[model samples]
Each structure stands twice: as C-alpha cells, then as structure tokens.
Target: MSREPTRAAILIRESRKRAGLTQQALAEKLGITTSAVCNYESGASFPKAEMVFGLCDILDLTPRDLFECE
Candidate 1:
C-alpha cells in the first residue's frame, strides 16, 4: 500500500525543485549531510521543529505555505 505524503516531504520536494537544487545543494545550505536530506525525502525520518523553520528560511517558504495549512 502507498503511504500518504507528508507535509515536510512535499514541501522539501517542491522547494528543491523550484530552486533547481539537488539534494546535495540543499544539504549544503542546511549544513547537513546529503544523506540526511535523502533520508528525509524518502520518509526515513523527519527534521525537528527548529529545523523545520530553518528549512523554511533556506527554501524561501513561509511555514504556512510549507505546511499547506489554513
């Protein structure tokens, strides 16, 4: 069965695509390993709350937009 897409995963995917960024590039911006970014995208794990905000800053996305929340 297919799992539902997570907000974080969707946001990360969209932001990276919009920026024309590879996981390695975004990982560099986050000061994290590329493997971590890969894992997050693969839904192997998730970032912390602070990292969520950090991702928003790096990705030029508002938290509401990133989460697609009302």
Candidate 2:
C-alpha cells in the first residue's frame, strides 16, 4: 500500500477541523455513524458518490477539494 495519505482523508480531516466539527457532529449531520466518519478520515473507507456530495455540502468543500492532493 502507498504510504502517502489519501486525498479524501486529508480533505475530510482538514475541512472538518476548519468547520469546527467533530466526527460525531459531522456524522450526525450526515446521518451516519461516527465510526464511518473516522473510517473516511483514516482512509480505511471511502464514501459513495452521493455521500461524497453530501459530505462536501456539510463540510463546505467542493468535489475538487476532496480529490486534490497537496
């Protein structure tokens, strides 16, 4: 596996922080479990396409933001 972080993980973490949202809070907003949020942030799992849009809306990020690597 690659050692580098996934863009989804980085974007989710940074955007969540910037929005002052905890995993629980974000999960609540998305109607998902906190563990799901954690998985996404840790790159252990990825959201579905529809969920991606939902996350972007809730986290104030664009689709590009989640795919862009720094």
On lDDT, the leading prediction is 2
* lDDT agreement with native, every candidate: 0.76, 0.86
Among the numbered candidates, top TM-score falls to: 2
RMSD of each: 2.6, 2.5
Write down the TM-score of every candidate. Answer: 0.73, 0.84
Question: What is candidate 2's lDDT per residue for 1-70, written digit by digit as tens?
Answer: 7455587798899999999999999999999999999889888888887898999998888877876743
- Give the poorly placed runs of model 1, Cα more than 4 Å off: 1-5, 66-70
Clashes, model 1? 0
RMSD of 2: 2.5
Candidate 2 clashing pairs, residues 3+ apart or interchain: none
Q: What is the lDDT of candidate 2?
A: 0.86
lDDT of 1: 0.76
lDDT of 2 at 8: 77
